[model samples]
Target: MLKGQPRATSPRPAISPAPGASEVFQLLRDGQPRTRAELAQLTGLARSSVASRVDTLMGLGLVAPYGGAASTGGRPPSLFALNPGARAVVAADIGATHARAILADLSGRELAEERQALTIGDGPDAVLGWLAGTVGTLLARGGLPASELAAIGIGLPGPVEHRTGRPINPPIMPGWDRFDVPARVQESYDVPVLVDNDVNIMALGERSFHWPGTTELMFVKVATGIGAGIISGGSLQRGAQGTAGDLGHVRVAYGGEVVCRCGNTGCLEALAGGPALVAALNERTGGTLTSSQDVIELVRSGDAGAVQVIRQAGRDIGDVLAACVNLINPSVIVIGGSLAQAGEHLLAGIREVVYQRSLPLATEHLRIVPSVAGDRAGVTGAAVLAIDHVLSPESIEAACAALTTG
Candidate 1:
């Protein structure tokens, strides 16, 4: 089990300054910009101790005093915030149909972003070359030097071998297996590179931004394919080969003739994925539905046929998720991807079956909600990964030394 936040601080504790200083820095990173006195109150340290730590951080150019507080019959307190330009990161999200790149500051605010339709199946070299060019363009446009970039992070549509930083035998992504994506990206930029599955990155984004207090969370994306990201016990569950949450290939209906890209039959993806749903709808209505957007518009217009198709697809998806819930018992289930735009019709079907089939204790207080991040989740998650990787203890110390000496 994962531990929760530490207990609240009491006034005037004799806390050591070294650990308190790092904690104070983390608090600021967590979006709590406070004065010395406010930080002292939160860290159970004296005002003088907080001031000493703040002085050291300011000397290192990592923290900056923004402005003074309103006077309350006393000296105004100086507010402090992290220096946004102290370091930067490059984030990339490589999906089946498209790829996006962004240059983000230390504060995780995007400085520049670019997206283009990706013909991923062409080969690994072509795809990587495209990503490198786009990243260079983004950096140049943002007027940021390559030296200022601390690290690069990529989220790919396939399973990643975390230790080796290579994609595995991913079904949908052709010619990506055995590719050393991180090493290749690092050669171009001369910075640390991190890579993971897109769903894992999305899960990180949700845990960091959307639901801060929760530890057990699940993000289900029903897009061109159906997949999930599992965050249990405050740690990502990257199974033996870092392919734990590849739910797209889960066999929902066995012995069916429909073939999946994975060379499997009757997988959940073949039943309720974006392509599957659109094909089903087109077959029934005898109309041409080119994309998931077409299905969303028809469903929104109260087309009974469209509604029925989506509802059934949702139920099919929910059945698999119900099994997942019974096993993982996550606190929240976030639904994302293009099909999620179907709204209540889809959610209702999922909720109905999940509650009916899952154990009472597992889902008694579970909340199923739509993702707030939407299409940007993958890119933002990639950015967060890069930021966190660069901000690790050893990396931070090295970066600080490099910047200070230079």
Candidate 2:
């Protein structure tokens, strides 16, 4: 489990900095209830101060009483926790061929979600309009009004200028270049919008929620395209151009005469991505496979040609990741995306090559595993982005002050 914030001083017998409503809310965010005395003791604030902050938070609808704790002696004190239904967050994960939307509360508990087919080639206007309509429907389904949403987050399939939520020269998305995505979305909902690469959000979701203990991690997605999400020291690495871990376009030393979608030749994606694997299998088996899903089904049903190419793709991917492991030395490497569903054939090939080529120390503690959340990782990570943005110290302070006045 994620650890709590370090105490300003020790929890036992020490005078510390005064705790504010944010501090009190953080304490309650652990999903456990604490009485005024317990909170005061933990935060090193006076019982009176604790009460004042708690009352303010209660009025903001972020915290609520959950019944009384066990009484040691005197009267049993009322316990308080975060109200799971106070506000909702809207998160969307837009991929090349599909999109997922989720409605979650302040605590990251998902309320409702919808997944549907969406083509990125349809342009941002059509996609954003569809997203707005879907969000309205989902909010209605969850019995939430539009005013209850605190923020919106989106993960796109291409490189994004994170500050403005705009796609910057995305290769796959034809009409999204330099598009003001956040501005367009805010026109519909009038809320803070966050945008990032789809793989970056997947890495965030994996690290923030699933592997909290992993400070150094990498999430590699090998679907229609190949890319990586790097988390160093528990934060996403977007690099100078917000395209840090773009493993897809990495040029292969041995690849020759293969053209990539980016108009580059001999790129890694052309050599080992899902489309490449499918093309190789189709040529080998003389069968028509339209999508990566077909390749996955073939691998699942024990097709020799599909299995061989997937393993080769894994090794091809591992060759690139071996260099990454030596450079970053991530403690964990989570394999996700469409091809990951092929199971151990792909993982085994990656592990075989990565451990063999990477430094002994790097490979010793490195865990190469498949993604646990699977398809949900993108949406879950988007929710994390929104929740963190809303609960940030600056935002929290402003919100608390506004609540006190309102």
Worst 10 residues of 1 by lDDT: 1-10
lDDT of 1: 0.81
Compute each candidate's TM-score over C-alphas: 0.84, 0.90
- Cα RMSD to the true fold for all candidates: 6.4, 5.4
Candidate lDDT (C-alpha), each: 0.81, 0.86
Tens-place lDDT per residue, model 2, 1-406, is 1122111211222122233678877787766777899899998999899988887767666667776679889988887877767778999999988999999987788889899898999999999998888889889989999999999989999999898889999888999999999888888898899999999999989887789789999999998889999999878899988989999999887779799988899899998888888788889878898888899999999988888888988888898999999999999999999899999999999998999999999998899999998988999999999988987767767777675455
Error of 2 at 169 (Å): 1.0
Error of 2 at 286 (Å): 4.2
Candidate 2: residue 233 lDDT (0-100): 85
